[model samples]
Target: MLSTESGEVNCITMFKSCLRYPFHLKVLWLVILLGCDSNLPHTNEEDQKGQTALVPQHKFAGTKTCVSCHTKEYQDWQGSHHDKAMQVADSRTILADFDSAKFLSNGVLSIFYQKDNKYFVQTTGRDGQPHEYQIIYTFGIHPLQQYIVAFPKGAYQCLQTAWDTEKKKWFDLQPDLDIAPNEWLHWTGNAMKWNTACADCHSTDLRKNFDVGSETYHTTFEEINVGCESCHGPADKHVTFYETNAKGTPPPLYMHNNMRPKELVQKCARCHSRRAQTTSFFDYKGHFLDHYDPSLIITPTYEPDGQILDEDYVYGSFVQSKMYQNGITCRDCHNVHSLKLKKTGNALCLNCHEPGYNTPSHHFHKINTEASQCINCHMTGKLYMGNDFRRDHSFRVPRPDQSVEYGTPNACNGCHKDKTPNWAADVIVSHFGETREDHFSDHLLAGYHENLERLHELISNKTYPEIARATAMYYYASRISPAEVKKIEKFLNDPDVLVKNETIRAFSQLGLGNYLPQIKPLLEDPVRLIRLSALEYVNKYEPNTQRTSIYQAAEQEYMTFMDMSADHTSGQQRKAQYLEAKGDVTGAIRAYRKAIEIDNHYNQARMNLALLLYKEGNTSEAEALYLKVIEQEPHVSYPHYMLGLLYHETGKNEKAIEYLRQACSRTPAILRAHYNYALILQQNKQYDKSIKAINEALLTFVDNEELLYIRLVAELNSKQLQEAYNTCLLLVELAPANPNYQQTLQEIKRNLESN
Candidate 1:
């Protein structure tokens, strides 16, 4: 049995091992090379089993040893946020005034206090109850410090509130926002809830032993912080070989000698990526799918340019950059442990780029000024999470010409919000004297902008790079003309899979056409995503022959992919959505169930499966699945709304009202839940309550024709005929083409005249 201190020491040793090993060997298997030595006892059997003994205890060398050789690096890392990322909140670390301060956000209340110089926060919980908890840990030191609250189930969630280290106060993240009272899962929940999702990458050694039966987590680990070993592999063997060998002799360990720039990138990508984990980590070097899952869906996580959005860090953004393609590693600019830039601000870029690259003459501006900074002109800043300022990492050139061509924001125009892109373009032209034309202007700007006709001609010529053409196809698809549609239809047979995929996506947006037959062949495309895209396209417009063909192909492909060693759960979910849209609810349900089997935490598939079950009158099963979904992700509102509807359908009005209120209180999808609640109130003859619910629904959907009609009826029933008449007239004006709106307006007018 391992004592707590022994466990901590062993974990530290493992972390050291991580730093010593090469990045590639760590990602792949290192035991295969090192554990196969014939001189070691039981080496043959161990080699066959692919197992290695625990590294010798004497070989362990802590960060202190590293400081001797790299003094400057050690000093920079000592006071860094990474060093104090996870620590016990005390007089020194706890920035919040915990002596006597209370905060109330929505209906949830939290009280902060200190006992024995240790900080703690007490808050009202999900059960509408108050609980006091000692703050056992803190995550992240700079920017904010998140506290971990203890719960009976060992559950924790990162509180939306954070300690403002500079201001010395606890601030609510959503103070002015009107979130519902029941939405406890909003960032205010205990930090433990997000641990399984994020803590692994941020911390050193994280274990998630979540038990579904009792809904409890017994997660434990050696370190509460991210260390060098998190990115690098174990270093114990390397240390051993170095110390045991003579001073002049070469070490016998395989270091990261061949880790080129690209290989180094993949290592950084493991955490800095905008991907989903395919599996959980049972041990180091576990299979990706077996332990962690990654999200591949087109959600808010990705930008329009296919860069990583604001969800995680800027890893995806860097990958799409010219710097990365030209060979730039994370360590080239940023220190490993301290995680700060090697040089400050714009000076960092000057290390590689010449001073004249953005000199006064080159930038058409005076040098040694605020505006002269390359980042200011190229990477525009945006406000995120209300107060946080972040710069775009796309590293795009100042394309003022394209800005005027399209409506895309340029760095120059971004700084001078009052000035037009054309104004910026004119300034550039004046300064540079139009010596050179824009290199990518034709395809990037003029082709997609002022010269659509000429762009169409160029696209049809097919002399450009397939990627460039594919990019043009995306822009053209957005504002598709009849001629452009025809031109794109011909490219369904393009050899480039990207072009073919874009063509199919574009063609699907145009109304059903003769091109449906031509696009049918892509349903059996070699690429799984392309096939999925084909299925999506057919389901949208031409759902007759094309839909059936694509559906069959998708099913076959799904089975083929599943039967193989690789898991494509997201692809399966896409097929299920297609089946659902095609009215094959049963088939869709099976596909969704299979997707859930592949990844139990896939909330989208699980929710869809539950909704399909509800539609098929499988209320009991649907209810079970919905509860499970809520248990996993209480933040999601659809499950609660559907559960409320299920209760209403089964004649449990009281339960329906409770769930409906919860659903409405939690998310922006409150209109549907409020409307349903109004209907239930009307059925119960609660006129005043029904009117109130309808009014709330109306407020949420001020311009919605259906909602206006519903509000008018509710007002009329409540003896407010004049108000109903006015609302009816507004609805008719807003939705003149809506038959329901016209009928309601006429009926209300007749009733008013009769009265």
Candidate 2:
């Protein structure tokens, strides 16, 4: 998703990664986090086999409808988090002190006051000036409460300044963030806008009717707060069934008492998961994948070893749990209506676990202490949204051993902050045997670190979570070796829908050449997500004016998917890509322009737009855009690298060298930057500098073939016959299959022998 000419690059890297899975794979239970890796499986096929259904068209009876017949459930839901999810700001509902209270952060002072019984905050507005704004609604009931303010163009913004309920003090969420008025992360920016980010989850039956052309939001919701119908399907039919008092009415065909574990999880994941929305509005139909592309166990969101690094909501982590695999739903531990834990402490864990597990012999800790608590170790906690202490749902045994090598967070080091991971690892080994048995986290780490052997094995292994294997494939698919790429064609028919979807997505980047014939079968994929992923590749490579019914259907789904997220900057970028795929350059350009209009700071949009303009020979504007991105993000190397390429193509050798040198200097080594920079230097007869650049790059990255080739050519041109001969030997020995390298080696040997 969110593809570029290169690959899926985020303009502003936010929730694009936003899930955490566990280290434990099976006892040995790794819950396959249902994200689009880099966002798993058929061990999972039972619940997912035929789950896709049309969105359930039902009339909303509302929360009031259930109050009469379901008094007990109504009472339980009342005063719960769902009921108080959102509320109109008033004396009773408002938690923040609006009595001319003052709070300052990042050199800006915000004042809150009640003017004529209406809540108002004097803070830095969209224009980055101090302004008083009327508060429309109060969001959330727990650790922190954020106020919603109506802005122009029908957009409602969630203010960054929030009341920390526990501390009973006003606090700004982005305390150190000093953004410009037009910046996306600014208070009035689209990021903090309620209509896009908060509305869908806080309210029931939200319809984010965004006008992409107008750049406006006509967002609507069934109820102000998450209501009964939010979790249960629309209850109008249930109400009708009860009101008629008729026998053989068939109970209106909704989720009843015997709800499957997966079904219940999906109901919660509608709002709980960190994912990409596939639909404009959510309805009780299709699988979780059909509605949303969940974030996989990827870096920046989750740790490399699959620990929570961001707000995962819950679904991503929960699914990776043994509890979920054992068919345990949220209701098993939590009261469905009240949203409270069914039992407290060890009693809750003891419901399923053995009594022996509760003893000191098992926990190896003193009784009746924080260390003795099962959740303290197994369910490690992290602070999110400032003060909300949420625990990772991927229940796992502490693995300080993995942490020792990988630098991943472990439960042991979480509490034993003074001790090193190695010390913790040693303690763990002593307590629970040195041989911790094989876990998927080991393979996951191995694949992440570019252990291709481990990655190749993981791609086909079914015992590990399918999502983890798919993530391995995500990394493995970028292989320079033809043999590795060929190995992946078989996985195009991976029984797991997640694996199959990702396999096609990878080839979509690789283009539709040899894999095109094998991909035809996936057009008839059982899952809509997979079919759509298949269509993306086919449409990009095999462009057609006349299409088959399957192609047309998949295209329609892709269009809807794009339109659903049209308001988002990422969506606009995707729209631009979609148009470009279909040979609509003008439309693609316009979409990119619109994306920039939405958020001026979107780097990828500018980077891609510049590319299209460069191709169209609009060099002046393209050059200006690249410069603007450089000015905005001085640290990012890709823009510099692209600019360098552009300059070299235009025959501006000096400017090209300057940008390429800057690119090489930036962090997270850009391999091509070094190659191009060194080649340009050698081309300009700066042999010593070229040789030095290659050596410097080699220090950071493993000896790459292209860099070595560039060096070999540079050495030969410089009349360093012995150096040329030596480099050619390494280059040919490293990759004997390359005829160019082989021929060059033969020429170098002859030149060296003659010299």
Candidate 3:
């Protein structure tokens, strides 16, 4: 039976499926019929087995509650960007011209007009039919502004076309992205839904309240827009404490008022960061991880040297800054109420830095020029959402040398668009002497190349930033050597919480059961994030029977965290993996199913579910799912490779070869697929084809010992004596000390001499 959340979502999904047919009456009738028992509580069995339901912990008191006492702050906040973040579409709020304005994008003519004092947009709807949708809300204030349209099944989708607030013209938010009518990434699709993607951070005390079973949202918010209470947390308790005082003595220690610099930054990060929401809403009292999973300095979102590439929204980039490590927080330079710089332009930097830094002699440019600004060189900006230029917050010295070596962007080259990185590097050397060799990017780039020795040096260097060290350890987690684990263990008690948390995660990835004793104590660590990581590692070990109580306690906390995040795709996947490890097959299946229900295009969930089904003797279902994933992601090599493996396991050699060949033919072809296909070809006496496939694989993994060994075998079998000798020579270079490679090379050389 489906869980309560799943069942509700299914009902709404079914209703929504019929919405395109001009069947509003029929959909309403179905909703009415389903409501007969929709509100009833779940059965005892469901109560026992179902995941924990989220209950909101705080109540919003609104901006008005604080306005009387905080008059000056309220005045400042009234006209700020946050105050205008969201609003009801009306004369004052609507910024776009709605008097029959026409905008053309991607061969579609979108018309914006007013009918009977209400805003309406004539655009392509979810059904790929041109229909007029009433615009209900204005999404944002500056640079660009979007409108939200309320659709059937409680859907609120943001229009793909937005008004360029600065340019005062309509523009497509995704100019290059051409979305198909039926695709999920379309403006009419699930991904563009406001409640899931943009609602949480835009409003105060937002409860997405998405019912997974019905595939519908009953989203609620205490305030319609980001309010005073959004960052300050609920003010009810503080107000009560003040009112009860009667004498008007200074309010006792109130909510989040005594937060440290780190705590304040984390509170800001709850909304500002590129992070995944673990809990429905942050309470401001817990660790950042207690409510969310902040994105690491990984690819796509950031450059390899930790510069912003996408709209990371500051938190991830700021964390990598020396300023953060040296106790600087967001509020230091920004006014918390006004959300503006305390001092405009270079004056902000001059507050901490010497006044000499503002001079031409120090900057090597005119004093008042844009190039002389501290942020122009140190922070550098990227233009996103068409014209919105945001500055990077990593606060690193411009390293043109790194840009030359690793193809990372430097402020020098960023400003000097016509100049090459090499030119910029040369200019830096001439201006400030030779470039420093001690840079995190050098180590990070080395880690990318899988140089474990260089990574070890970074991880062990006490002077290095914890974020750099932590990221180095993350890279090492995949290609870890046995000796490296001992060194990693030393970081379990690192001073920085990020280092400790990352070390625990690396340990969990290692799955080293021998360190169970060392890991168990961390299960009760003070920090929620560290304790959770420790719990995952402890569960992997599953420890002795004597430690059952200790294990159970930590497991409960870990499970609570997972269940709270079940509203998210990652949460369900994590829960499924944990349940599968604990031998709860049924529970794991439910979790995986829930994840797929939340996001049908979740490739990892589909792959994992298929693998699980295959293990449980459901081969047909697994094959169907594998095919479905391929249909969605035609160019992805992983699904094809796995399907090939599945066919091989089932002794279907013909099918295996077909899928494996497809995998090998894809761009950046799968190495395993090439190797597997070559073996199968050789087994079938297709010797020439086998050598050709192996040669292709060798090009990518030139030093891979197994591929080289297999190539040598294929060459020798095909009676190519010289080629076999060359393969053996490459193998010897790959594994210089391996006696087997030495012997093989000798035999091949002798055979070549005889030939």
TM values, all candidates: 0.55, 0.86, 0.79
TM-score of 2: 0.86
* Reference-based lDDT, each prediction: 0.56, 0.74, 0.71
**Higher-lDDT candidate among 1 and 3?**
3
Candidate 3 Cα errors over 4 Å, as ranges = 1-61, 152-155, 212-216, 241-259, 480-495, 499-523, 531-568, 575-579, 582-600, 616-637, 647-755
lDDT score for residue 500 of model 1 = 73
> Worst 10-residue stretch by lDDT in candidate 2?
33-42
In model 1, the number of clashes is 33
- Judged by TM-score relative to the true structure, which candidate is superior, 2 or 3? 2
Model 1, 68: alpha-carbon shift in Å? 5.3
Question: Which window of ten consecutive residues has the lowest lDDT sum in model 1?
Answer: 26-35
TM-score result, candidate 1 = 0.55
Tens digit of per-residue lDDT, candidate 1, span 633-676: 67655567767777777777788787777777664344456666
| Best model number under TM-score | 2
